[model samples]
Target: MTTAQKRSDVPHAALIQMTSGIDPQRNLATIEEALGEAAAQGAAMAFLPEMSVLLDRDRERSSHHISLESGEAWLRAMQDFARRHGIWLHTGSKPLLASDGRRRLNRSHVIAADGSLRAHYDKIHMFDVDLPTGEKWVESAAFLGGEQICVVDTPLGRLGLSICFDVRFPELYRRLVEEGAELLAVPAAFTVPTGEAHWHILLRARAIETGCHILATAQEGQHEDGRATYGHSIAINPWGSILMEIEGGESDEKDYRLALVPIDPVATKKARTAIPLSRSRAARNITL
Candidate 1:
């Protein structure tokens, strides 16, 4: 594993909230504008929302229209921006066509300021659900699930990687904490119904359980394709407190915004000093 440069004790990070559409070019433009704003606001690291490149509910269109190569433009732009601004860029999940033509993977990337790829994580859990509101998702039909849990060494600290639905599984977050992760990134384009119901609870639970800061960049409002997403993008501390959240917004507002949240390693250490819950779990006895 490549060692990440140690940054200062207090690091500032920003989460970029956006509602993407079917047009990849337009999405790239929006991401560029958001990153620029984040850099100007003195964010040491910036995160983008899930489906950052494109968001189409139609399985056929999503599978056939988007390609991994299509994301090259956005990746290059973000790399240059990160290098120029001297900040880390966490580009949220982009649809990548797997070697097997049958499925695509929702992949998230962490890029260093020197324009090197630090790590990439394919989303392990797929959002396959049937909702009562006539809204349904069959992510398994279009996307393949990732097998390995990913954790990356970062300038600020070790970061655990996860996408939207993966947040529902507490075990994954626990595994990441065991591997020395101090922060967790949950980039999501959550549906209106589910986001409203469980988003805050799940995020806070993961943060408290792992004793890590949670940075969740999300899609808020309605997309051009007429899909409504829950748009309260937030950053939560290890103690399960919300540091910042974007509250009121219309369904289609394209706001390029950034929030600087302070992350303290000492605070995380202090929170875990008592019982060492994560370690105790590893040593627990189980009956077969």
Candidate 2:
């Protein structure tokens, strides 16, 4: 049996929904407060939204804060923080120097309870589009796309990591499921338009498709950089049921919400066994 099938622990995961500003220090403080609260509330793990460290659209101003040196320092600090709390931390995503060191990469880090780096995934799909609201995002112009799929074992079971725009692609989740992901994390900073239009449907579809719990922490409301995000941070079960949801609003420091939801590996097993989509697809030699 796979690791996911053998596990039966249901750990409570804390999802921190924030309206991160341009200040990395301020963002870090917010995360620290939320993590402290989550730990006090008995959460085994905590998740942050994309750009949790810094959310600046202006590359010129953001460049100073997003260096490889600064990113590493932030990771080290967070590692120590997680060690203190004794809770696993999935830092949604942060802006860091790419492998080439010329452009940036949207990277997610998974830190274990013991303060060890377990796995990290760079966002492979870049958001480059023009919407009806006249908002155009050209992520590729500044950030290099990653070329990997990352899944790792944790106390919560096998976790698949993806960021923001990666949710639009179904194949990634399929691959993650095939690799034995019992839970999927899609940390995002989604614009209001797309988040209203597609966020819940897309997440529910992925959960139902993969038979894995979906944990999506998101940036909400208007940011300091002038961009607005749709903030409805949510957790869905393998059966496509909404486990917990925190709605969005005006950016307020006091309004940052932490939602605690139990993640059960048994639910993943039950859903997959009942539907048997994975087995059916494999039996039919499905490929794309």
Candidate 3:
């Protein structure tokens, strides 16, 4: 008789970058094409950027069209694609209206190779900021905050989920690591100013501190609504090293791109062993 496989044997993963528009169909097609390319490049798992289906800059328009029932189309498409390609897929944040009629949740979904929904994470932190460069975002004004942090077990390893602005909080990553997360996902639609200043440093710090691989998929270039986003989607190792970075240039505008990255739990352990910061922190916290 054949034996059942263990959970720790999954393969390499990929992250997809999307410059989404107000049209859901266009966004779906763009992501589908990117997934096919990533699969061809030997990715066993892939992740999409936040707001992967639509980037409606207008608040009222987003609120008007965002529906949980109607949003099933995107999820169904992702599930079907994962099943057909035999890979795990992570759909980045979507705005789902709550039953209260007062707030919407920014949520993400993970699908297994068999087309099953493995887990879902509602972004706990809302992007409420007024940048020094005269740009402003008040996400809390339109969206409700999530109360729980979500971590999921995958074939590759345990993954802790967070969205754009959540990356700024170190406590969340520490808690996730305490929960035994070996991989972290930070899907974002970061603005050019902040991303240029803090993106790489913050992501690298999270990877180094938590001793986990970080899969960060980001939106690139200016949107149809005249809002600009920083690109350069990246995958980082536990030791704060960059594995693969999807580069964006001044005039380049292709956002439907995919980068295949290999993540090994064994390698992560070795990297952590070299420094042992997480261990040292634990030791220091102990009272004599």
Local distance difference test, each candidate: 0.81, 0.88, 0.83
lDDT of 3 by residue, 150-249 (tens): 8899877999999989999999998888788899999999999999999999999999988899999998887886788998889898988888888875
TM-score of 2: 0.94
Q: How high is the lDDT of residue 272 in model 3?
A: 74
Stretches off by above 4 angstroms in model 2 are 1-9, 69-71, 250-255
For candidate 3, list the clashing residue pairs, or say none: none
Order by lDDT, highest first: 2, 3, 1
lDDT per residue as tens, model 2, 42-81: 7888999999989999989987887774546788888888
Which segments of candidate 1 are over 4 A away from where they belong?
A: 1-9, 59-65, 69-71, 250-254, 286-288
> Clashing residue pairs, candidate 1?
220-231, 222-251
Q: Residue 139 error for model 1, in Å?
A: 0.4
Q: Lowest lDDT 10-mer window, candidate 3?
A: 1-10
Estimate, for each residue in 164-242, the C-alpha lDDT of model 1 and write its tens digit: 9999999899889878899999999889899889999999999888889999888877788788888777888888888
TM-score of 1: 0.90
